[model samples]
Target: MSCRTVASFISLFLATTAAVQAQTELGNFSNVARGGVATTFVTDFQAIGINPANLGRNDNARVAFTIGEVGVGVGSQALTRTQLRKFIEDSGEELNMAQKQEMARTFTSDNVLNLNVDATPVAFSVVLPMVGSFAFSSRQRVTTHLGLNKNTAELLWLGKDAPIYPANFNPATAPLVSEVLEGTSIQMAAYNEYNLAYGRQVLSLPAFVLSVGAGYRYIQGVGVVDVRSKDGQLEAYSALSPQFNVDYGSVVNNPSFNLQKDTDKLLQPVGRGHGYDVGIAAEVGKKLRLGASVTDIGQMTWEGNLLTANDQKLKRLRSNGADSYEFFSELADIFASGTDSLFQYKPAQERKASLPTKFRAGAGIRVGSRLEVGADVTMPLNDVAGNIPAAFYGVALDVKPLSWIRLSTGVTSGAGYGMGIPVGFAIATKVYELGFGTRDLRGLLSDERPYASVAMGTLRFKIGTVK
Candidate 1:
């Protein structure tokens, strides 16, 4: 393969693990895109995941499907330049002309791609005039994947050469020369959540309309690996030689050919867990709406083994009077002991899957018979240690020039440090409705950024009529 391809592959592999944390945290919140409904009783499937009570508002048996992309462009420049210089020095001699050229080309490609994640909801509801409204809805919660940054290739070059050699190499040297190359990798898997919810509208006094809802959120844990190295490199060769030769000699001489050496550690911890959500929305007047919800109120536990090999070998070599047989025997015992003790367990104490429990209140005003304006403010009540509290404010204008078509434009703030402009259109008839939206135009905000914008489109179909 071309050097650029190699670099791209390495860059992608290493980035896969490093970017997973960001994916797991950011991917869960995009479920809010399914917010619009056709009737004031708006039972759009999207809101069902947010607040089950909204499910009771559905006057019709409906199925909603939404496809969306949530892209983020983020880059960081470190204060140290010497690290880059050192990396060049170490890998300069081993790289062929082809590898050098490929590395250069791969570094320039933009890191942007659509998040390409989607959510769909299918619902059936029945509303008894004076009794209450009940509904059942299921939807895919959230999914995300992130690619690696090309700049990391520069760092990989630093570990390309070392002083030791593996059993697989034939080198001309005095006192035995070996080489080592170290590099970091990132890997991420698709994150998925399944949500099932139930909601009802309760009648109290005539002063206000009260709605209550609860949901079960099932979160699938994700695994990631940040750094990985192959045996062909100089370091792996150097490190394996002494052990390899001793084992080879012992095998040929007698029945006892033990090599009790421990391997280097490269694997990271893997973890998974689940949680729940409950919410309520109330309508005090014709144009006023208020809502509050608590999400991710539980913790997810992560436990897994660390990946590493060869530590025991190094230890054996350093021990006084130690031989190849001793090292092999110890190594066997370590592996035989099982992987349960290698993993360090950590618990997730953050609320709402790191997104935070949010309280929202908004108001809608009728400008004319054909125009309506609305605004909402959402505040996060809990804080995950070391993370900033996120708050979002949004305003939207809907213009209905005809009975079947509606145009919308709005701006959402608090994504990070800037505001995202979301613009879309909705087309509805008695049988079906389709909507499309685009938000977060600050794609050019960072050079090492992953996406230029995030957009979504949704289609809802009326399945049956409910009395």
Candidate 2:
């Protein structure tokens, strides 16, 4: 019943980040993560979100199925590989004076930190000669983004020890938090998605083939938090499933507290909505392909456990500072730690937000039977809670050195992320497929500016033939 409920909520996210995962757009396809190019490359059930038209492409398989495929990605502009690895190895370890200063300086920069987990519990697809291709898929996604301005970062990292705090400062006389922390925001959302799709060949010629597809998705929202401080103001809205078990402490007794407190199950959802995807693809001869798609064109309404922040001046400091780079703990301390919280909260009845909608297009080419190359561009259509902050561009190549083994690598940039080199390999046969990959190889080998990610699949197989 203490403020630790909120602390626990944030710690859960940080722990998940420390333990696991990239943009959830790549879904559970390890090959898509490796290539960083998906629009024209994914097929069958893998195309559920990327480009459904790929389902109608002339692939060798007549039936494809996969289960329990997963991907986890985590990245930070302020933490390096060494720091992240050390944090994971021994989180919350005390820091030396020099290390403290170093970390303080590092925190005083515009920072973008994120964690993404995409899991496809089950996916199946069938290619029919006259009925085109039909597919169904189920996925669970956890996506988060955190942005911090210099002043807010320094305060969160150093707490009362920050140099900006006067030696004789009094909370009663301190400047309003709104006036001090600008351009600081956090967003987290988890949801379950069920998709149905159909694709058919619309045009066929000796030299060209064109396909069109559409998809319908049912979404169950699990949790959502959208917080932002800007221009001398703060706006915070949140709705979490009872599964999170957040305790508001004495706030629950307040007249405004109407948040749902009952739970039916661990995975019970708090909101529901629907979305659609439409795509078109064309193949020129045996070597060239191009495609485009727009996805997640819908919104969700959160009616459970809705709360908004009441921005005010700082009241008290509960802790000196966080021990390590676990800023979420520090954030929890600053925002809602029992009586020491700088601000309070009130309940709301409902809220609505858009999905992470984006437009994608790409081109791919196959050379001989051993090499394929692709390029893709993704642009966000709305600045939603889960959408990427900027456009993304990538080029990837797949090399088949053996009939059953494939290697993939690519270079990707933009989307508010640094340059990354993706690498992966897969063992594929007529009836079986297994693969592992990363969106940024530097995360495994480099000490500076690494992006940690891993995507893999084992329960994958193909049956029957197109003919």
Highest TM-score against the true fold, candidate: 2
Give all candidates' CA lDDT scores.
Answer: 0.36, 0.76
Candidate 2 ranges beyond 4 A from true positions: 14-25, 96-98, 163-176, 230-233, 253-258, 262-264, 310-318
Alpha carbon lDDT of residue 318, candidate 2? 47
TM-score of the candidate numbered 1?
0.50
lDDT of 2: 0.76
Structure candidate 2, residue pairs in collision: 21-72, 21-73, 21-74, 22-73
Q: What are the models' TM-scores?
A: 0.50, 0.90
Tens-place lDDT digits, model 1, residues 224-327: 22222224321110001121212222222322222223345331213344556677767665455556665555543333221222311111111111022111
Q: Given candidate 1, what's the lDDT at residue 170?
A: 45
Candidate 2 lDDT over 1-467, as tens digits, reads 24554456555665665555533347765554544688777877888988989888888379999988888777777778877667555566777656766776766544456667788889999998898999999998887777777766666666667765787888779787776767777777888999999998999999999999999999999888777777877877777777777776666776665566665666778788898999999999999999999988888888776777767885546466666755555766665534555567677777788888999999999999898899999899986677787789999988889999988889988665678888888987888888888888775677766577878888889998775
For every candidate, C-alpha RMSD to the true structure in Å: 14.2, 2.8
Candidate 1 regions with alpha-carbon error over 4 angstroms: 1-42, 58-118, 121-190, 204-207, 224-272, 304-361, 366-369, 379-389, 441-451, 454-459, 463-467
